[model samples]
Target: MQMMMAGARTRTTTTMMTTTTTTMMMLRRVWIPVLILMMFGITGGEERTWNTEPAYETQGVNVTVIEGKSAILPCSVHDPTSADNKPVKVVWTDQWSTILTFQDNTIIDDERIHVDHAFAREWNLRINRVKYGDQGIYTCQVNTEPVISYTVHLTVVVAPRLSNDGTGGMLEVMEGSKAELVCNATGIPAPTITWFRKTADMGERRESEFCTGTSIVRRYSSFSQRIGEAGQVLVIHNVTRFCGGIYECVAENGVPPSVRREIQVKVKFMPKISLPSKRISTQKFY
Candidate 1:
């Protein structure tokens, strides 16, 4: 009986030892996996949030202008080829002018301005004879996922410019009778003509600059004639005393403000007069 009891006790002790060893083995496996997971987490570092501000490829453009001269508002752009998933929308605006809109190729025209060509994605705006009032902040808005904008400030400088052809008369005219004033100009974009005359009050008056004579100053005949392949001729016919004055011929090339040329007209006649009135006074008395 004593031996059987001692055998039972021994088996119970062995069973308890086995159970403890199994629990310790299971804990060792769990610890290895937990340590690996913690190490990976430590090396991974923290995640960063996305930036909310809009991305810009470049800064604004710079524009220069001459007062009393025409200019083109220029804006530089970069093609975002990668982010081309969305179409680009460009909007240009000036403080004193209405909003100008542009897309891939088409341009919109309004009463204030006109687009020379739209389809080529040329967003250049032509400002006729830049005045001080025309200078302002021009903004270029490009739309994609986030909107990108560029601002260009136009600086206008006051400078003398030729606004018209110096010639008031046609290319040819009668010799002794009368010759009209004639003038012409060449420039970029194009220019307008305003005749000026020396007045008693002001050295030059824009309104009365054309005529102070008996000869009729007909309507200004304007026609555009093609010169060479790249040249052009502008003609105005039937010039007279009224057509004579400080003629302002302005030429603008879209970049540099308008340029001008000043011309003086002087009519010459024969030394001899054929009329009988001068000799008749001597002969008629008889």
Candidate 2:
């Protein structure tokens, strides 16, 4: 009877032990996955902290442009670190920018703004058209822990135009009045100037304005002549009634269109009276 009782007690203890082990195993299985999921969720939620590295400190760059032309500015980083590795927000400013920001850019409003991918590490500023006032210092700033800034100088050069240099005015002189016909032209290539005169012959004049003649003293008759000279200047020493006509100055650079100026000369003098003034006074009353 004792042995049976002891055997029953042992089975009861074994069953209790088995039950406890099963319960522990079930608890571990259920808690292990739950603990792991919770840990993962907590870690992931904390991972994405709004963080960015400081901008790599650098200096401004230099650029050049011609009047009515284009220009570009480049900004780069040096001695990069985690503080300087993240994408940077860049701002560009110009000392002489009329529009304020270039197109698409906040600095000014025009169609000339251009930004590239490398801007994350290096900033590039591009202008479609540059003007005289556009030449000056430009600044680039990166927003970060320790904001980095850069500067660049821009030079704008304009080529002289024919409109301003090739233009001239007319020269007015009275007929029989001693005068000179001058044609002045200014250009880069030193434009070739020509002067001519239109006579009844319809041919170029044999004598240029510089030639000396007695026509200044003689009574001038009816003669309409067009005087034209081809040179930098055409000078007529003594002008007469015959010389009073259309004077044209032509400037040619072998280009499609040449510049020309026309001057009209009108001769005026007191008409001679048939009867002398002294004879009329001496006759007195008839």
Candidate 3:
């Protein structure tokens, strides 16, 4: 049951005629919606409205997701349920093809990707267990006037893995010059590198014509810190014959299973000449 409140008031309205004629007036009552005052730029509620069209409100933002995680590509619009002129169709796509279609609050199923349209304005696509292959541009389109859509860049980061071509072995340089080595690695968190060198004299000394125990190279420095960073350059400054040894670059990003690359540096130099005393032709006088 509801109750209504009505106020009744009476007012006498008079009008003057040109020929001093009698005036007659009538009373009328009217009601209006108080909430309709703020619509279509109309002011003071004069019972007049302007025609305005609802704008297409589909826009997407870039998203970055880590590997083994999940991500959501957003595609929201205003009054998606209202099919006034054109039925609004929300479709998510990669650079290739359509991923999912949203129609009447229902979406096509693909198991890994699902719709999150709980909020009337939210038309989002969820991707579970994201991987490196999922990194690319994703688009969300609403088949409206002029085709309103949005593009989102999805970046998936994984652990680092060294590539064969990125690792150079048996690198050489001339004496009094500089030596450079490359250690190429691929993965997420894009690995940072540190270089180390193991000398040829690091082996154990044998007494009985053979070595018994194993020798380990435990000393490793963080390199000279002159890494060029494009492929993690390992530099040997002022290369000399003594600088020839095993150079190894280790790449790590706090991810499981760090990658390592090894290179042998051979510093070439001219051999020293030592000759015995030469005998003269005086032997003929004896």
Root-mean-square deviation of every model: 28.6, 27.1, 22.2
Global lDDT of each candidate: 0.47, 0.54, 0.58
In the range 250-286, model 1's lDDT, one tens digit per residue, is 3445545545444444433336657655543455653
Q: Model 3, 42: alpha-carbon shift in Å?
A: 34
Cα lDDT tens digits for candidate 3, 173-280: 898887767777877787888765544332311221121112333545422222223347656566656566666678888776777877877778999899999987
Winner of 2 and 3 under lDDT: 3
Q: The CA-based lDDT of model 1 is what?
A: 0.47
Candidate 1 TM-score, true structure as reference:
0.31
Runs in model 1 lying further than 4 Å from the true structure: 1-58, 80-86, 96-98, 104-122, 160-286
The parts of candidate 2 lying over 4 Å away from their true place are 1-62, 79-84, 96-107, 117-121, 144-146, 162-286
How do all models score by TM-score?
A: 0.31, 0.39, 0.44
Which lDDT value does model 3 have at 253? 82
Candidate scoring better on TM-score of 1 and 3:
3
